[model samples]
Target: MKQDSTLVFIPSNLIYKQTGYLKGCKKCFENSEVYYVTSNKPIRNTYQYQCIGFVGETVDFKDSIGNIPLFINSKNGQLSVENNSSITQILYDYDRFKNSDLIHNQSEKYGQHFKYLSEKLKTTREISQNGRNSITKYILFLVQIFDYILKITRRIHQIVQKSSTFAHFEGNITTAKWFLTTLMEERKITPKVGNTICAKIIDLVIGVILTTYLFEYEQQIFDFINFNTEVIISNLRGLLLYLMGQPIGLKLNYSYNNFLGRFFLYHISLWRIFLQGLYPLFTGYFKFLVLPGFLGFSYQIAMISDVVSIATFHSYCIYIYAARLFNLQLKCLKSLWRVLIGRKFNPLRDRVDSCQYSQDQLFIGTLSFTILFFLLPTTMMYYVVFTVFRLITLTVYKCLHIVRNTMQTIPIYLLFLWIVNASSMAGNIHIAWKSFDDRGNVKIEAKLEKLPLLESVKKFIPESESPAKNPRGFGEIFHSILTGTIL
Candidate 1:
């Protein structure tokens, strides 16, 4: 399923005639000598040349020959052939391909007609609401605005890139390399050791500022944190009580549910008392964390956040317990059902195999399956509730880290370069049509090409982690949720 990676050979004169015209003469190269050559050169001019047509390769016949379409089959990644036609153009690489204006006249002619049709379709969708809600429509509007701006910016960038005058600058190789390194990679202005020292200095300054502020209001911050912890504990206790008595209309096994709820409630109470006892130690530790925060690492701040989340450490423990119990019960139910059906799972083969179970074993399996099946709902309810709490905590932590990372990694150097002299940030080289020689050969000249300012800056900046892209993918999480598997 590989394409012929061998080179394609077409007449230079044929392409030259096609290059500078609004519409190329189809038969301009009808009699042109085009050959398909192999890369292997075991023999010289003794090798037979397979003469191809202007657009499609030809087959010799006794009297007449026919033209056949030769194209790459996208699905199979192979060269394919069909009769009577050839692929004149390929609309691949949609984004870059459409952005190009190499065949300007043809593109404009088609573009004008398609523009009206596109507008009509969009208007029709808008009138119909397209099954979109108000929020969806608003979000779509924002997206459209963003896309329009991006498109216009890219178009301008393309124009500048192709223009010979725009990207020309008088600079040495060192300056050029520095510009490219700053724009196309992480902005590294100094040696590695120097960068490390500079980073340490910045961290020290930030740490000092943060430490000064925190120390001044240490009691107040600790008091606020303790008060929030108490409120959270009270709220959690209330929730457990409500769950024990069926807050929702759905009926649950009251005795078992109550037992679980009371156990967690007791755990929470103990955790609160323990936390109160360690208030002084935690306060001192929190103060000490300012030093690491001053070192200006996002992960250091994340570590502090993790320690802060320990206020709900007991809730996390409950979640782990419930998740494990639920998971174990599910496994037990599955195994017992398999046993009842006289089949056992073989780990080595990774398949179920039939087995002859004794009557007593079958009875025991049936009893176990029935018990676990009935208790599953209760276990799941606890697991799901605690998982929600855990997710909320994680979301807050992730947000804080994202904010910190974003602030710390802002491309200030790239921004300054962009402001002072944006053309200096060029990372690409473009070959422009310079002139034609006396022999009618096209002369080309290479020029430095300007990269899109936003795109270049974005490249240099370390992006913050997106909340949607979690440790597990969306499909995995969805499957886990549907199957009642622990997150």
Candidate 2:
């Protein structure tokens, strides 16, 4: 008898790793060939005796609709040669295939609530004993250290202000702005609050200060006590331009408030997030490959890069907000389009709430990794080396903050401390929870429900059979109900 039919396997372990599947396959396909196709290589099933890894894409799978093929691949294995004429080819590309595995695993294991894959599973005992060994704790720890140093910086400002014509700005927020003037004056850069030329000079001074914090500074070497204690902030374009070593412009986002304009706006933010994520990886690669540096500056540069990582974290937070904003804007535009076209559309009026999103929680979750990465890829570090690396990281972080809030009257340190405390308190009380779910999909508990907020975040942390129907995003509960859909 000649081999007659095929059973196509996805680039997933669930298909191959199940016990007795190969034996079942062997018995069923005794004559027919079983094709194991994938783009990326799969890890061998160590449990099985005849396990083999599948690497690279094989024959591309084409879908035949209307005409049912001899075989149709289902999530559960139920296809055979007798029931079907041919096996349906499920072509697996490298990126799409791996992502499929991630989604499948998360859904299979976690079901409804999707969490970060890299996040270690914590037991109740572990949670009680060590707390969540999450990046949030590391961020909180590093942030506390910076908070203390901010107090010192405020004292320095107080003393410095006494001697200069600059009066003490009262609010905690003004400490940073006031400090910028002090820094400019100290550098002989000439602070002119009333003069346009002076304003440009101040920006020049700030720019130099920003570059010094970002690149290298003399004080960074000597100021061991004031480690990672510089303040800094940069607009998206400026940071990209400096890091990439070329002047680049933003993708033209035209907002005409018309049909075309709204459509473009709806799509723009989603693409923007991908671009932002790529930039950090780009900077990381560029530093390691293109920008060669001495081993001496290795740790120092690594420390500075901590701020870069944190900035990336901040950008991710912004991306989340952008996503939320786009969701609302898109829904309205879609509604308008339906109305204009005289389509049956239900206006959801009950669940309307102010568009409020949290930027801090996302930062909190990523902060741990930002600090952790500054220490390098070492899993085990000597105690002394770890302490020193931490100190270096703190120094760099502090420096960025100091530069960013240079002209502020209020101490940025205290403000940061407040945010941390607020985030922690609110989160524990169910006000501002941060589950740090895979990508941007966040399912909150109390605070969100009390306020009756909608989860506008979509296509993030996708689950296979999500109870929250539309993984692309089930809009506000009210909207779902109005549409007679329970997403």
Candidate 3:
């Protein structure tokens, strides 16, 4: 008996195209009765078809959206058979059964993508952090340089106030050179490498020397005006006539006690270092006690002293105020007397000759003015030359090694001074103009209001705006631009 090769079932509502008998088969089977699963709606219907074929033979089935193909047993007409599924079924089964493999592949892909992104993010963050740190350090370094410049400027101002003559300027120049050298050398090895060390040294030295020369030239004019005619005549004539006349005048005026009194007189000099040492101790007390009690008391005292010193220096020459000229003159005369008179025999002559100022005509004509007249010029010249030379050498060194630009070589404090002066002038002008305008406006308004015709006109015309009412001035404009407030 042969089983059916094909089985077709027709439901009650469906039609059949083929209803043939089986041929050349061992068994023939009748078709199973078809049953339709129906819903209340006519469109919802279901049917099933089954066929038997030879074992291990390839079978083809129609591809439909809602169809499932299955193999059947041909001999027993049994529905049970091992199904060789479609590609879609194989993919679905693999996805369902291989859960660990799917998870592993997804995790590996995600991790690689995440690592790549993370590496990029880390690099970006590092660069950003480094840039911020670099900028912060650069700004801090610039601030230190600025502070140093301020300190140097203050020192320069102090030096200038101390000695008006060019000769004393040398000490200041030497100090400036040494300071700059130390600063540049330290900068080269420290937190910031100075880019213009050579240029700065060169420019500063040159500027100082030129300034000193100018100051000395002016000082010579000042000295010439102050010196007496006799001193000038003696210096111009180059004569020793003034030295011989001193002894006769001293013998005419001297008493024994007066002669002996000059020898025993003590010379006292004030030491600046003592005051400097006191400054630190006073500063601590100032910070802890004095400052809190009265704000800026110590600072005001310093400022007052500075002002007084400046006033004194401007009013009287440094040598006169310091008494150094008198001391130097006395020393010079004493040396001259020791050379001329024998040490034991002419004791009275030695005492009279050792006086800084001579009483006799010869000494008065030749060397009496030495204390004020000759010394001032010599001191001024010496200071001018020394300072100029020191400055020049320092400048050359700086030009060769450090400074690169003209602007960088200029002292920053000078520029600040210029700016301050200009600003002060501008402020004065602004204030003056504002005051004038405000006062004028009141008069104008009163007149306008009082006059009957003008008052009627004022009803139609707007009141004139005063200068005080005007918007920002030049200073405000400059400030706004500098602070980036009005961009």
Best by TM-score: 1
Number of the top lDDT candidate? 1
The runs of at least 3 residues in candidate 3 whose Cα sits more than 4 Å from the true structure, single-residue gaps closed, are 1-141, 144-301, 311-325, 340-487
Candidate 3 lDDT, tens digit per residue, 1-487?
Answer: 2222222111112111222111111112252111111111112122331222222123244432233233223343222212321111100111111111011112341233222322322222212344655665665676566567656755676554443221122323443444454443333121111223333444456545544553456545334433432253334222212211233252222232233222212110111233335445644453342221122122222233342333222112222322343346445555545433422224756444332333464465445444444444333332233233333433443342222223233334323323433211110000011111222211000000111322222221211111111146668745533322321
Q: In candidate 2, how many Å is residue 273 off? A: 51
Give a tens-digit lDDT track for model 2, residues 117-202.
11111110012334434544554565565567556656776553332111111122242343344333332221122222322244
**Model 2 poorest ten-residue lDDT run:** 448-457
RMSD (Cα, Å) for all candidates, in order, is 20.6, 31.0, 37.6
lDDT of 2 at 14: 36
lDDT of 1 at 285: 80
Of 2 and 3, the candidate ranking higher by lDDT: 2
Candidate 3 has what TM-score? 0.18
lDDT measured at residue 242 in model 3 versus the true structure, 0 to 100: 25
Model 1 per-residue lDDT at 398: 56
For residue 215, give model 2's deviation from the true position in Å: 18
Name the 10 consecutive residues with the lowest summed lDDT in model 1.
17-26
Better of 1 and 2 by TM-score: 1
lDDT of 1 by residue, 178-218 (tens): 33343223222322222233434564576567767777898
Whole-structure CA lDDT of model 2? 0.32
State how far residue 229 of model 3 sits from its true place (Å).
33
